[model samples]
Target: MSQNLYKTDAFTIEYIPGADILKGDFLRCKTSDEYVSAIRAFKEAYERVLPRYTFWDNTRFGHIITPEEQKWTDAFLNYPGAQKGITEKVGILVSQDILAMLSVYEIFEVGKAPLRPGFFANEKQAMEWLTRKETPVAPLPDTKPLIAVEWDADNAKAVIRMEMEAPDLPYYLNRFKRFLSDHDFLVENLRLFQELTRRERKILSMVINGLNNGEIAEQLFISCETVKTHRKNIMRKLGCSSYSELLRFGLFL
Candidate 1:
């Protein structure tokens, strides 16, 4: 058997073969806990055991909306090695009932690009739909012109949504790439933040939260002396003399 890639998060466990989907409250992607667990379960069950993972996403049904929803979707869609078993992965399922909740443009695109091939009302119907081979229709043509792109400097986050027709897609995407390049500082900071040791980051986070040595120790289940040591180490690594300064520089970026 292949070694499990995601043993840490509970979310990943659901997709594993023989996974107890009952343990997962799969109503929707609400919390990080759910996302992490579902990801782990799915990774082990579907992708690892079998050679194909047949699943459905309810995004077209208006299930997902927030950025967190988008993040988890991105994770599952773009997860490393998750596609090993998936030859023809499905992206969205648009039903007549769901169509009423969305727009004409939305349904049109779902019927065009980004829609799953075998979209049915239920999983069984979907499986049957997938069994019968059918040619996928090509994506709709884009003929709109480009305009502008914007990002949130304070949050160091990018939002690509804009009001435009389909033809402007190419220019809009090109502008998005340029926006990403222009915000190199935020990107570098995010990379460094990810690279930092978990404990180090946790300690820095606690310090930024205005916790004293004892409080930090209590929260982390470590001793006060250990908390002091971690504090000093964090300050040294971050090159900050005071907690306020560290919070200002380290947390913002």
Candidate 2:
């Protein structure tokens, strides 16, 4: 059976109250072109989300931080709130393959000694090292793995779905935010739209802006009864009987 990767909340590190940790992804690539593409994508994402995070590029061996990057790290390190808190510490991971190619100076900058930042061969190791001081993370089941979703949009609305089995619901939701933002669909709130015919997406778009059933009916060009039926289906599919519960799903409209 496929194990649930998300269910390991106890093992996953949580953001400290005021510490802003930005995840910079660097996936393994088989070819130079593939590596270039991954680098470009990571760079673009980092720049776009810079305002919200202290970005760290995780590689195979350790983190890659430069003089230019020190400005962001310094700001967070100097923040009174972060300084007084234990959650402000941030680290990076570099792949073992990439580490072998680094120059002595570059490797020195990333390794211990002058730079106290932790290094790891993989993300799980990096996160474990970073969070080791507080509590030891449990061993992860090799079976269950993190899953990704792809969303498709149609005319002002997006249809999102997934197929992986998960152990943690909240983590998957949090992970989806990057996809939502990448597609420019991240919004404040969402509501159950439709249950049958995959109308939940349309309803989410409408409800995120506080649309009532009648308004949704008009916008969707359906009768009030039909809209109600759709709502019922949505509630059933989502396992939520109340509008409040539905909104909490946080679908970006």
Candidate 3:
């Protein structure tokens, strides 16, 4: 049997009868204000249940936290009754979003060493760590996996699906941007490589290995003028202004 301690639009917290564990997760975080309220409710639930072990699954959480809200959370964690010692161990199934992780860190950072919070990438890992057993107890069977789809028409006509948030969001966003740029370059390079003749590809391999026109001509028993013509065509098809620019594709091509 389980006792319901906290119930909100954003979360559901319950206390297990025989296990003496308080377990819950964010249901669907629509707003940052709602997240703050849910945390308050969580504290109230903790005051009543006072479980020895706890687990929070935050896989579906998506909140754009403001700096002022962050300050409130810090203050809430520092309150006299907060983290005064209730739960001995905590296992959290964290969200994939890098920014949502900041909230998890802020909430539990106030706890003493005895609390010993464990962050997990998946529910199986969290449950195993919480129970200290080989087999996991699946608690979130009804919950759906988090998936967000975003299509950028301006860039490559591709779809990128990842819900990002604040507090180091710029760092992750920049990383994604760099990845997109590299992906675009590779796609264009592959298109050019596909358009080349079989002989051009073979010559390109040698050229990419720092072979000059005369060396490539001798190895393939072709004229230097033939190698030069192929080199010119390769650069034209690959949209490279110079040999140096085309040489960058040595590894990739």
Candidate 4:
């Protein structure tokens, strides 16, 4: 059985008792205020209901999140009492639009949130994944030291291990920063590609394939200095700090 927790012109949220999950279906674009209200409602219901409820978000008709809404969501989820240990898992089903998928991906990558989230293209797969029981691990001995050092005869190297009962806040925050930074590079790369001239795209394609500036210049019949200038402009436009970063971003190309 499912019960309606909240509903509006833009969205509907329901609690599915059988699956122990909250389902949020977005029907249309929403204003910033509406979006905030919806999130608040979801949080309130999450607290009021049983603990460890999975969240199934269906955003086939949802709009992209604005920067302001994104900030608010980050703060809300990170609030001390907001969602600490209440959610078990989150499964998000996104629309066909790439931008819509990216918007939802941004939320998951923000991190430090209580939920373990995964994105999916369909509801059935999402549900199956959410309901699957993970193999349990026995708890570590409390008497173990925080850090242990051992000699590995096979590798002929000293191995150091730092054990923790749970991941610290800083761990998740750093992960969030890395995920967002990498995705930001990819997004910028796509935008730069769109802004590039035909000749520039050709040069960028070569660069992505590991061509040196001099090689690109020779192949394109351009001056070496001109190739260097083009490379500089490409880096600037894509906001990549190093050639390696640019190469990683090139995967999207």
User: TM-score for every candidate vs. truth?
Assistant: 0.31, 0.25, 0.46, 0.50
On TM-score, the candidate that comes out on top is 4
Q: Is 2 or 3 the stronger prediction by lDDT?
A: 3
Model 3 lDDT tens row, 64-167:
56666655655664343334655556767667665666655554333333233566667776666676743333223233334576667778466646543222
Candidate closest to the true structure, highest lDDT: 3
Give per-candidate clash totals: 27, 14, 0, 0
Q: Which has the higher lDDT value, candidate number 3 or candidate number 4? A: 3
Tens digits of lDDT, candidate 1, 16-68: 24421111223454445555556556545554445333444433232223445
Ranking by TM-score: 4, 3, 1, 2
Residues 29-87 of candidate 2 have per-residue lDDT tens digits of 34444433443443344344332222233343233344443343334332322433333
RMSD of each: 16.8, 20.0, 14.0, 16.8
Better of 1 and 3 by lDDT: 3
The regions of model 4 sitting more than 4 angstroms off are: 78-83, 114-116, 135-253
lDDT of 4 at 73: 71
